[model samples]
Target: MKRRDILKLAALAGASAVVPGVLSEVRAGPIGHTGPYWITIQAGWGWDPTLFCDPKGAPVNATYDKAQIAKAGNIPYAPSNENDAFFGKYASRLCVVNGIELSTHQIEAAFRQMWTGALEPGYPSLAALLAAGLGGGAPMPLISAGGFEETAGLVPRTRLVGAQPLDWASLTAPSADMASLFSPMTETRIAQYRRERLKAKLATSLPPGIKSVIEAAEAAELSRPKLEQWKAHWPSPLSDDPSRALIQLTLAAFKAKLSVSANLWWMLDPAVTDAAQVENFNDWTARFDVLMDEIEAFGLDNSVILVASSGGGRTPMYLDEQMKGHWSVGSMLLLGPGIPGNRIIGGTDENLRGLPLDPSTLEPNPTGVRLRPAHIHRALRRLAGIEASAEAKAFPLDAEDLPLFS
Candidate 1:
């Protein structure tokens, strides 16, 4: 029979018949250490570190012992004692870090929450550590709320899963090409095309060895219909809001153990201040809380880490005019095994300066000023048993300014 005829016949087979054997071989393995999971929440917006973790409490100055203030900078302590009450409930599980230099923009309310624990900047770094601890593999490092972006940190071009850069726009309105590939109808059509194309091409160049391989692959893909299977496996339709999809995707990735790191970016652009946007943000946050509740239900606290945060600072135009230009500092929170409980670490100035002070040396400079986000990442890595240094080597900073898990 003609090779074209053989190719046509093979295409009639489905993908399951051919793909299963291959997929089983690629499944990820169990975690290397069974250590506690490390969850990192990456708050994209500039999070005011002062809110949840304060140093020397809002009114900071020369009157306050510079050394003492520096030492106490990352610890949550306010003079009026008003802010301290906010985080009283979670005090045991919380460790507030202050005086760490931040590299993003801030909003007022987010800053307020940081000092008071009313708002928590969930981060991605912590999540990556946890996923790694769970024995997942690369290409799934961080799953953002919308999608991954270039600015989302982590060394790009690596084998890390979920490391591919994502833009929020892609989440809401995925490219036509991707949509076509992921669509069931399109896959069916493409399968047909593959069959027809294979036949036409084989008629012209039919090398016996190549023909055999093509026939086998075509027969395998046809027999099982991998695209149909993938369509079936694709997550249930989620809300168009990228944030909601983000939470759902992260949960799915974790449940499937397909990725070791996933970053969920909750809405960051202040431009999304419309009613729809607010509702989307609230809904997404609620979904995130639900995810946490689910994790707790499974008693898998030690297996997963959830870190939350904004992208950059909010613009004055986005906030009340009275609070223009005054951005809030960012925040960080963690809940899982191997983490201290009910404790708040770090402090923020009344003006919202997160100053990190060395309690032992009693000094505060840019290097000593605040809890660097990288320190939190380092701490999480330590918890996960990853030896990577958290702080950027080129940057002058110390991890001691932050609290350690006891």
Candidate 2:
């Protein structure tokens, strides 16, 4: 495909999710990495606990029954009727944390707290932090499928699919006409110009954020081969669900040994919840099961950290027996290496209200403080072994440590 045609296609997509970096010469080597991939699966909008994680507290006459609550060793999960497929495959490895309130009623605030740990600016999403910490020398350390993802520090984001995925594919391959543009003399001149421009740009006083962008631009100029490497491993059948497609892309990156973390999201449409809750969660969990299978097959199971979270929790089953607005509490699931499996943390009243949990014990503590995104942030920092570093420490968790987890 022609390079202009690719750009045209990308332009047609309305908005662009630009991959951060410069776009000039080809990169010399494939981006590879050791183990330990941190991945976050977003159960966005508001999630129904009865349908997936907190079924135990659902009303006695709700859509899901207590009998459906299954135990695989020590894990107690209340999956919707249609979610047997997901629970069946992942129950053993799952660690379900309940009654942890995100402690916010506002949607936007909830979103910021869920991913970034704090309500303040300059602190990027957990995915960005992990990518920076885990991806030592990779150009694209962080990858996102659209969430509260940001580069708080000097790290760069990679929107490979961008405004148009098909156009992105073209970037991985250069047609004969496109290749002809790169001649020896032209390459030398362009490289020299870039160096000079970079030096001049550096000499000027620029904000840290702008400086990072400039640096990313320089890196992008030389990421052609890396993009091509990604294109070569792109999954076929990309899938109708954007999140699943991201899963494929993330898995492909892992198999190619390129990145350490990727973020994904799933939606909870309130209007459709009354009728489609069962089908929705069944599909979501099933896709997650597929991800687990792929990770295990890659022999990186112990090196991977899988986190499932959301911005809000759904209201109780009411009049029509469907979930409604956001609640102060929600659920989070953590699986993968070093994380204890088959355990449930925190608790709620029998009526499904979220209560605080002692971070140190991972148990309910009304007298203690409520758990927020910042607390999870710190615990995760400890779990991933980056809590002590200056970068990781810069974004401290709001609550205290959950020693039981460590």
Q: How would you encode candidate 2's per-residue C-alpha lDDT over 1-406 as one tens digit per residue?
A: 4455544434443223333223421222336676678888777566766567666633633655777676556656665454555656666777777776675788777877777888766787888888777664575566667667777754666554344444454444423244577886776676668767976897799998888666655656556457656545554434445544556666766666667787876654443364465566766777777777767655667878888887756666464535466666777888888777777776666666767665456666777657666777788888878888777867666567766455
Model 1 misplacement above 4 A: 1-35, 44-92, 103-144, 147-249, 269-285, 311-320, 326-329, 359-369, 388-403
Q: Write the per-residue lDDT of candidate 1 for residues 1-406, one digit (tens) a residue.
A: 2333322322321111112222211222232333333334544334323222443321322223334332232344322232333344345555544443455444533332332122233322334334433443332333333223221233211111222233322111223336545776776676688778767766776888777556544443443322222223224443333333344444444454344554544444443333333343444445556566555643555676555454323222334522324344444565556766654555445555665565444345456535555556555555656545342222222445334555
Clashes of each: 116, 8
- How high is the CA lDDT of each candidate model? 0.40, 0.65
Error of 2 at 163 (Å): 6.2
- Give the poorly placed runs of model 2, Cα more than 4 Å off: 1-32, 57-61, 79-81, 120-122, 160-165, 169-176, 180-214, 235-244, 271-274, 297-299, 317-323, 355-369
Pairing residues by index, what is the TM-score of model 2? 0.80
